[model samples]
Target: MNLTQNRTRIIEVLIGILATQLIVFGLAIYMFNEPTRIVEAQGEILNVQLDDAMTLYAQNCSVCHGLAGEGIGATPALDSDALRTMDYNDLEKVIARGRFNTAMPAWSKEDGGPLSDYQISELVALIQSGDWIETQDRVVNLGLAPLIPFTTDPNPALLAEIGNLPDGATLQAAVQLFAANCVACHGADGLGTGIAPAVNDPLVREKTADELNRTVTLGSPGTLMAGWANVLTTEDINALVTLIQRWDEVPAGILPAPNVPIPVTEESLALGGQLFSQNCSRCHGPEGQGTQRAPALNVKSFLTDTSDLAIQQIVTQGVPGTAMPAWGDRMTESDIQAIVGFVRQWEPTAPEVATPTRGGGGGPPWLRNNTTTTQGTGQQSTTGQGQGQGQGQGQGQAAQTTTQPNWWEIIDWRILLLAIGALSIAFTLIFMGVESLKARARPAPTEDKSQE
Candidate 1:
C-alpha cells in the first residue's frame, strides 16, 4: 500500500476509536446521572446479614459505586443493568482479571489482587440479590415501623438498664456542651484515635452507668484520654447519652439525606420504609433497634425530646463534631422528612443520647473497656484479635495482621479495578488505532528485483 493509503486507513481507525469512546461515555453518562435503586425493606439485599461479602462492598464499593450500588461518574452502577446483566461469576472475573485496556485491573491474588477466591466469591454472592433497584426516598419515615412495638410482656431491659442514673440536662444541651469542650481530644468527630480512644465506638456506647462510673472515677494512665471527673458538674456527667447514641456514625455516618424525604401518608411511609431498609438498615438494625455501630431512632432522646424539625436537621447536617457525618447531599428534603417520620416510631424509651466522657484524669463507668484483663488498673489497652493481653497491644501495633474487615477490602479492590479498567479501555482504543495505521502504511512487498 502507498503512504497515502496508509494515512487514510489510520484516519479511519482513529475516527472509529473516537466513536467508541463517545458510545461508552454515552452509556456511562446515563448511569452517572440516574439515582441508585433501593431494595425492598425486607429484601435480602439490604435487610440481609452483614456477611463477609456485604462488609467488603460497604468499605470499597460504596465509595464511588455507591452504598446502594448506585454509580457515580467515576464508577459504574453495581446494581443496575450494567451489573445485573452480568452473571455473578462474570462480575467476579471482571473484579479478578479486570477489563484490560481500561482502568479496571485484575484484583485476584494470582493477578496481583488482594482478596482470596473465597472473599471474592462471598462478594459476588452478596451482589447476587441486587435489590438495589428500589428507588430510595430522598427522605424517610421512621413511623412506618413502630419505634418500639408494643409487646404483651414489654421487656424494656435494654432501655431501662441504660436509662436513668442522673443527667437531668436536655439532650441537645449535652450535645452542645460536649461538642464545645470534649471533641478536641475525643475526636471532635466521635471515632476517637491516637491521642484519644474510640469514644463513639459501638461497644463503648453500650456500657452501663456502673461501668461508666468506674471509668469516670478512676483515671487511665499512660493513655492521653485522661480522667475528667473533677472539672465537670454532675449534670455534665449524665449528658453522655447524646454522645453514646451518636457512636454509630458509619456509612460515613447516618444523620439523614437531602434528596431523601419523609412520606407522611401510609403510601409515603411504605415508600420510606422501603428506602430506609435498603440504605439505613445495614447500620441501623433491620428492626431499627440500633446496631452495635449505629444508634436507634425511636428512642425519645433523639426523637420525642427533639422536634421532628431537629431530626430533619440532623439528617441533613449530621452532628458536626461527631462520627455522624452529614447525609444531606445523599437524599432530598422529602426523603429527609420521611426518615424523620421513621424515627418517630423508633422511641427506645428515651435514648440517653449522651456523648462520650472525654478529658479524663478519671475512668468513668462508661470506659470499662479501656482496661484489659492484664491490668487490674483501668488503662487503655489495644486488643487486636482477642488473643490475650500483654503482647496483644505489641503485635497489633507492629503488624496489624487484622485486615480491613472483609467488606472494606473488597470495596477498595473494586475501585482499583474500575479505575484500571477505564484506563485499559482508553489505551486499547489508542493502540488499536495506531496498529491499524501502521498496517495500512506498509507498501506491498517489493517485487524481487533479482528476478528482473
Candidate 2:
C-alpha cells in the first residue's frame, strides 16, 4: 500500500512541476516580446500610422517643407533630428505660429495662422511617420539650439547722429544713449549685425564729427537702418556721438579697440573695455571691426579734435536720423568721461573719411549746414594728417566736430509704406477666401416640400 501511494505521489508532483515550468516560460515570452500578441489583439504599441501620415504630408506639408521634407528658399530644412524629436506639442505650436524674426509663418490657428485643427493634427501625425532615428549624417541638435537674437530695425540717422567726440564726458554720454536704444540690435559692444554696420570699427573712428553727424542725421536709402530725425531731439543727437567714441575702449572680443587709452587717467581703460563689450558689441562688430552695415571707427578725427564744448554738446544731444539715439538720461557725468577716455585710446584705421551726404528735406536750419566744425579753422583734414594727437584746449577737439544732416523724413515714409503693405495683403486674402467659401455654400432652389 505504501509503494503504490509513493509512486502516485511522485507522478503527480512531476506533472505539477512540468505544468508550472511551461506556464512560466510562456509568461516570460509574452512580457518580453509582445509584438505577436498585439498583432493577434488588433492593437499596436506605438501608434505610427505610416500610410495615413505619408498621405497627409504629401497633400499639405510639401508646399513649404518640400515633397521630400526639404526646406525651400527662406525655410529651414526639416531634415534635422532636432526638428524630428522636438516635443509634438512644440512642433504644432511653431507650425501654427509664424516666427516674428523669420519667414516661418504660423501654419496653425493659434498665432493667427491659417491651418485648421484637423490639418494641424494631420501635419503632426504625418511628420511623426517619418523615421525619427537621428542619423549621424546631420549633427545639429535642435534640442540644444538657442533662439536667434532680435534683429535691429534701427534708424540710420540715429547712427550718424553720434558726433565726433572731443571730450571724455561727451563720448560717455553718447555711448550711454546708444546703449539704451541701439545696443539691442547693434550689440551692446557696437559690433554690427547682418543688417547694420559696426559702430566701433577703426574705420569709423577716422570720420570727422561732421561726417559722423551727417551719417546719423540722414538715413541711408537702400540700407536696413531707418531714419530717426523725427524720433530724436537735438540733445539726443549729440549724445549718440559720445557713445560711438566709447567703442574706442571695447576689448578684444567685442571690438578691437585699445579702450581706456593711455592718457585717460580718470577710469582704467580696462574697466571701460569691459563696459564696452557688455554694452556696445550688439551694433559694433566683435573686436571693433564694424559689421555688414555699421560704419567703422578706429579713426583720429573723432576724439583728437581740438574743440570741446561742441563735442560735449553733440554727446548731450542726438542727431536726427539713423539708429544712434539719445543717452542724456541713462548716464552720469563720470561714466561719460570714462567712455570718452576709452575712445581717445583707439587707433584710427583710415587717414581720410568720405564726406557723407546729409539726409532730410528741409526740416531744420541746423541740419542744412554742411561744414565741419572748424574750431574757427577753415582747413579740412586729409587722410595722412596727424589726427590722433589729442588737442588739449578748453573745449577739446569735439568743438570743431562737423554738423550733422537731417534724416528723419525718409524713415517716416518707409514705415508708412510697410504698414500699408501688411494691411493690404492681410485684408485681401481674408476677403477673397470668404467670398469663395460663400459661393460654394449657396444652395440650389429645390421642390423639397413635394418630395413625398
Candidate 3:
C-alpha cells in the first residue's frame, strides 16, 4: 500500500508538473503574440480606413486630383513624398478647410461640405501612407478607368515665351486644363459649340494676351460664356489665353469619350454592384434605398420611369445646382453604364422606400469572408472552395479572396489558455477521485504475521 501510494503520488506530481509546463508555454505564447496582435489589429483598422478613403477619393477628389493622386491639370498631386511626410494636423486642416480661392472645396461638414471630421482623418491617413498604387488598384477593381499619366513633355521655347504664367504651369498644363474644364461646352480643340464661340479661331488668335485674358476673366454678357475670374486663378487665365493664341502649337488634347451602351452581363452586374457601393452608396445608400443626401434609386417609381440610358446620363453629366457632381471626367463611360445596369436590375421587383435611412452596414471592411446572401431571401449561401466566390450582402461581388482561417486564427488564445488550465485542474481532480474510490474498494491490507 505504501509502495502503491508512493507511485500514485509520483504520477500526480508528474501530471501537475506537465500542467504547469503547459500553462507556462501558453503564457509565453500569449506574451510573445500580444504586441503582434495589437499591430495586426491596428493594420486592419488602417486598411478599413484606407478602403473608405479610397472610395471617397474616387467619388469626390479623383475628378480633379487624378485617380492615383498624380494630379490632373492644375490640381496638385497628393502622392508626392512631401505630402506623405507632411504634418498630419496640417494635412487634415487642408483637407477640411480646403485651400483659399482654389478648386478645392471645404470638405468638412463644419465647413458646409460633404465629409465629416472622421472621414477627413481617414483621408489624411490614406494620403500620408503614400499608397497611391493601392488606391489606383482599388479604383480599377471598382470598374473605373485608371488615370493616364502625362508622358508628353512641354516645349521649353514655348515655356520661355509664355511669361507671367502660374509657377508650375506649362504648355501641357494648358492643354490638360482645357480638356478638363472646357471640353463640355467649347467642343474639342476649341471648335466651339452653339452656346460658346470658338476661341481657337484666327480672329481670336490676333487678340493680344491682355485682351484674351480680359475676355476669359470677364463674362460675355447675355452669352453662355461665364466669367472665370472667380473660378480660375489669374495664372490659369493666362495659360488659357496662351493656348488660344498658339492653338496650332498646342498638341492635340484627348477628351473623354461619349457614353455608349454597355451590354449587361453577370460579370458587368457584379462589377457594377462594386462600383455603386464604393462610389454611390454614401449618398444613394447601399441598396439604393436613398438617404438624406440623395434620392432612393431602387424604388418602383424611379426605376420604372428612368431608362438605363437616362440613368447613365444622370450619372455621367450629373444634375447641376444639386449635390451631384459630373462623373464623366472621373469615371469611364463603360463604368457609368455598369452602374446604370445595376440600378436597372431593381426595376423588376423594386420596393417602395417611404422613409430614408442612413447607409453602410454590411460588416467591417476588413472582415471579408466567403459569405453570399441571396437576394430577397434571408438565406446565406457560400460558393466556391476558397474565399473569392461569396456575394457580400452590400459589398456586391467579392473582389479578392482571403486565406482560410486556421484553428489558431478562429480561436481566442486567452480562452483556449483558460480552457487548458481548467481541463488540467479537472483532470487532476478526477484522477485523484478515481484513485480514492479504488483505495476505498480495496480491503485494508492486513499485515501478514505468519513469520511472527
Candidate 4:
C-alpha cells in the first residue's frame, strides 16, 4: 500500500511540474507574438511615409538634382558629405528660403514657391538618409572622373602679347587674374570641369565684347559667377575680354565642327541610335530619360528651349563648368549629325508616353511568344516524372513535399536561431523529466545482510 501511494505521489508531482512548464511556454509564445503585431503596425506606417517622400522628391527635385540626388550640369550634388553632415534645421531653412544669388529657388509656399512645410520636411528626411554614399564610393573606386585634364597654362605667345600692358591691368594681367580667380572653377585650359562651363565654347565666343565685359564686371545674378568689379580695374576687364575673344581664332580641329552637313534619313537615324548607345547612354540613360549625370533630352521643356544649331554646337564644343565633353575631334561630322537626328526624334511637341503593349505579356513584347513553349515543356517534365511512380506512392510523396518547410525560405537568421534554441530547450526538459520518472520507478536498493 505504501509503495502504491509513493507511485501516486510521484505521478502527481510530475504532472504539477509539467503544468508549470506548459504555462511558462504558453506565456513566452504570447509575449513573442504580441511584439510582432506592434512591429508590423509600425513598419506599415513607416513604409507609407517613405513612399510619399520619394514621390514628392521625384516630382519636384529630380530634374536638375538627378533622380537620386546626383547633380547634373551646373547643379551641385545634394548627396555629398556637405549635405549629409548638415543639421536638420539648417537644411530645412535652406530648402524653405533658397540660397541668394544662386539657381536654387525658394521651395516654401510662404516664399511664393510650391512646397508646403511638411513637404520640405519630407525632402529633408530623404536627403539625410545618405543612401547615395555607397554609390558615390563605388564611382570613386571606378575612377569615373575624366582622364583628360581641363586646366593648363595659357599659350606663351598669348602671354607675351600682354607684356606691354600696365601692372595689375586686366588684359596684360589676364593670365594671372584667371589663374588666381577662375582656375578653381574653370580649369587651367578653359575646358569645363565639374564646377564650371568651358569659356572656350563657341556659344561663349558669340557673346559681344561689351556683353562679356558687363558679365565680368557685374557677375551673373542667378549663378555662382561673382563680379570682379570690386577686385579688378576697368583696364583689367577690357584686357580679360580681349583674351577671351582670342578663343574664337582657335582652329576647328582644336574645337572641331562638322565640315559637311549630313541630311536626316532613316539610315542616319539607325546609325545615330547605334552611336548614342555607345557614346551617350552612360550619362543620359538608355532611353534619354536623364540621370544624375545628365539632363533628360526627351522632355518637352528641353526640346522647346534648344535649337538644332545649339545642339550641334554643344555636341561639338561641349558645355563648360559641366561634365559635357567635346566630341568634335573624336567623332566625324556625319556621326555627330546622325546622333543629333536620333535625339531630334524625341523633340515632338506631344508628351512622350511609353509605347502601349498589344497584349498582356509578362515579359517584353519580343519574348511573349516563348512563354507558351516554356509552360508546355514544364508540364511535360512534370507528367513524365509522375508516370514513373505508383499513384499511391506519388500522392504520398507529393503530400510530404508540400508539407515540408524549406529552410532556405527563412531570410532572417535571428528567427531561425530562436526556433532552434526553443526546440533544444524543450527536448532537454522532456529528457530530464523522463529520466526523473524512470529513476523513481526503479526498485530501491536492498540491504546486503550476508556481506555485513
Candidate 5:
C-alpha cells in the first residue's frame, strides 16, 4: 500500500514539473520568438537591398561621382548639402531623367540606361540613409575643397559678345573677357590654378603669334580646349593673342619639363594602364572611348593626327579656359611620361589596340555579359541532335543561375546560444526534481538506531 502511494506521489510531482516547463516554454515563445522573428526578417531584407545598392553605385556612379560620392572632374559632388536638402522625389527624377546639357546621364533602364526601378529605389535609400547624410555633413563642415574643382557655365552676357569685340581691344577689355569667361579655370592673373596652366609660361610665350592664333582659333583636339573660331572673330582672336604675348615681359617662373624620358616597355605600359584607370578613367572612358564630359583618345582620327610631344604637353600643361586641370602639380614628370607611354599605344598604326570593356572598368562582374560559342559539324545537324544540345545547354544555364544564400537563411548565433542556455536550465531543474522525489521515496536511516 505504501509503495502504491509513493508511486502516485512521484507521478504527480513529475506531472507538476512538466506543467511548469510547459508554462515557461509558452512564455518564452511569446516573448522571444514571435515579435523578434518579424523584426529580424525585415532587417535581413533591408541589409540585402543596401548591399545591392552599394554594388550598383560602385559599378555605375563611382566613375564620375567618386567611390565615396565626391565628384570628379566637371562632376558635381553628390554627397553635399545641396543633395541632402533635396526632396527625395526630385533626386529620384534626376537619377532617372538626368540634368539637361550636363555630364550627369540618366541611370534608369527605362530611360535608356542600365539600372532597374527597384535598383534605383535602393540607391535613393542609400543616399538618404543616416550614414551618408552624416558623411556629407562632416565633409561640408570640414571646409575641404574637392580634388577636382567644379565646372561652372560661362556668363551668358559675356558669351554673347564673343565674336563682336572691337578691333584693337584694350588690355582692360581683355582682362574683363578673361575674368568673365576664363577666370574659373585660369587664375585672375592668368597664372596656373587648380584647373589650367599659366599663360605666362616661357614655352607659351615663345610660340609665335601665328601659332598662338591657330591654337586659339582651332583649339587642341582630344583636350578640353574648344575652338574659338566659331565663338570669336579673327580680330578678337588676334587681340587675345596680343594680350597673352604681353605676359612675357612680366618675367614669371617657367614650369619645368620632364627630366626622365618615358621608355616604351611592357612594364611601363602596365604601370601606365594602372595610373590611367585611377586618374584618367573617371573623365575619359576606361579605354579612352570618351564620354559626354571628355573626348575619345582612341579614335582613329585623333590618334593619327595627334603627336607624342603634343600629348605630353597637354598632360603636363593643361589647356587654359577648359575643365582640364594641370596634372604637373600633382604627378611626377616620370609618372606623366608613363601615362603618355600608355596613351601612345592606342595610336592607329600601333601593333595592338585596346577595346573598352562593357560598362567600363571597376564594375561588378554580373554587369558584364558573357558570350559563349559552340562548335558544330560542317554538315547540317539533324533536328534531334539540335534539340538534345539545346536541352543540355538549358540545364547548364539553370545550374549557373543559383545565387548565394541571403542573410535570412542563416541562423543567428545569439539566438542559438540563448536556446542552448534555456535547454540547460530546464535539464537542471528536471534533474533536481528527480533527486527530490528520490529523496522523498527513499527510507530514512532507521537501521542506524538498531545499532544503538
Candidate 6:
C-alpha cells in the first residue's frame, strides 16, 4: 500500500512538472521568434519612413535636387555612391544644421526650421539608402508635379534643320536655347551663378564675334562649362554669340518662368477640397480668402513665391508667434499633402487679396488679453487672465499628445488567445494529475467478510 501511494505521488509530481515544462517551451518558442518579428516590424517601419521621405523630397527638395537626386546644375547629388556610403552621424548633422553659404537649409526645429528631429532622420535614411526610383514612382502616384523638369544641353542630332532666318528670329531662338540649357549653370539672362561665369559681363562683350563663337564651340577647360559644339549647330552657336555680344537688345522678362503646373487629379482635388472645407475653412475661409483670424492663402504673391513643399511645411508646422497652430499631431501626412495639392491649384490664376484689417489687438491671439464681448446691446466687454488660461490649455493639450499610446502598447489578440490556450491546457493537466492522485490515495475496499 505504501509503495502504491509513493508511486501515485511521483506520477502526480511528474504531471505537474510536464505542465510547467509545456509553458516554458511555449515561452522559448516566443523568444526564438522575437528577433524575426522585430526585423519584420523594423522593415515595415523603414518602408513607411522612406515613402514619407520621398513625398517630402518631391514637395520640398526636388526643385533644387533632381527628382531622382541626380542633382540640378549646382546642387550636389544625394543619390551618389559617396553620399550612400557617408557616415550616418555626419549626414544627420548636415541635414540638422545645414552647410554654411549653401542652399541646403537647416531642416531641424532645433535650428529654427520646419522639420522635427525624426523627419530629419527620415531624410538622412533616404539619402543613405540611395533608392530614389521607388520614391519617384510614389510621388507620381500622388499626382504631385516635380517643381522643375530636369534639363540638359540640347543634342544637335535631335535638333531640327536650322534654316537661314532673319536676325530677329535668330536672336529669339538663341534666347530660348540659352534660357533652357545655359541658365542652369549661368544664372538667368547669363548673369551667372557661383559655378558658372557671367556671360553678360564686359569680358564677353569686349570679345570679337569670332572669339565668342570659338568659346561657345570649345568649352572652357577645367570649368563646369562644357562645349556646345556637339550639342548646338553652327547657326545656333552664331545666334548665341550675337545675343551674348548684344545682350542689351534682349527685352525685359523674355525668359520663360520655370513654373510647371501642379499635377493635381480630379480625385485628388475632390478629396482635398472636402478635407479643406472640414479642417481649414474655419480660419482660412472657404476659398482661402483672408479671415479675421488667418491670412489669405489664395493670393498671387503667396502662391507664386511659396513652393508646394514650403506651403506643406507651413501647414504641418504652424507659424510660431502667430494664431496658426501646428497640425502635425492632428493630421496624417497624406491629409496634409492633400491640403497642399488643393492650395496649389490656385497658383496659376490666383488674384491678390486685400489684407484683413486688424482690430486694436496687440500681440498674438493667445498672448493678448482674453476678452468676452456680449452680443448687441451695449457691447459690454470683460477681460480675463489670458496667459494663465492659455498656458493651462496648452499644458492640457500637450498632456493629451504625450499620453497617446504607442504601437507596442496595444495588445495583440492572437498573443492573448495563445496565452489563454496555454493556461487552459496547463490547468487541465494539473486537474487530471490531482484526480489521479486522489484515486490512488483512496483506500481499497475491504474484501467482503459475510461468508466468515
Pick the TM-score winner.
3
**Top candidate when judged by lDDT against the true structure:** 3
Off by over 4 Å in 3: 1-19, 32-36, 137-452
* TM-score for each model: 0.24, 0.25, 0.41, 0.33, 0.33, 0.40
Question: What TM-score would candidate 5 get against the native?
Answer: 0.33
Whichever of 3 and 5 has more TM-score, that candidate is 3
Ranking by lDDT: 3, 6, 4, 5, 1, 2
After TM-score superposition, the amount by which residue 377's alpha carbon in candidate 2 deviates from its true location, in angstroms, is: 89
Across 1-452, the per-residue lDDT of candidate 3 in tens digits comes to 77567656866786777678677767866875776566566666666677678766755565457767888667799898898899999999998877766556677777656678998998998898736766664443343332222222334454454444443345557766776566544655575532246777889899999888877776454333545766788887887888888776643433322333334545456656776776887887677777889988877888767666568768988999999889876865556765777777767656654345654565222222112231231111111111122222333112112212333663576557667776776777677677666655553444334334
TM-score for candidate 6, please give it: 0.40
Better of 1 and 2 by TM-score: 2
lDDT winner between candidates 1 and 4: 4
Clash list (residue pairs), candidate 5 = none
Clashes of each: 110, 110, 0, 11, 0, 0
Clashing pairs for predicted structure model 6, backbone only: none
Name the better of 1 and 6 by lDDT.
6
Clashes of 6: 0
What is the C-alpha local distance difference test score of candidate 2? 0.42
Q: RMSD, model 1, all Cα superposed?
A: 25.7
lDDT of 6 by residue, 262-291 (tens): 445444455566667667767776666557
| RMSD, candidate 2, Å | 32.3
lDDT (C-alpha, whole model) for all candidates: 0.46, 0.42, 0.62, 0.55, 0.53, 0.60
Looking at model 3, the pairs that clash are none
* lDDT (tens digit, per residue) of candidate 2 on 1-452: 45445545655554565465556555554453454444433322122233333333433343344435655444466666677688999887776654544434455554444457666665665465443222110011100000112222234343334343345456545555664455433553576432245777788877777676666665443332434454556677766764564566533232111121222332224433544454443444323333443443333465456233233334435445866444444543223333344444554432234222133122222121112221221111110011122121222122122112123522454545545555554554565455455444332222343463
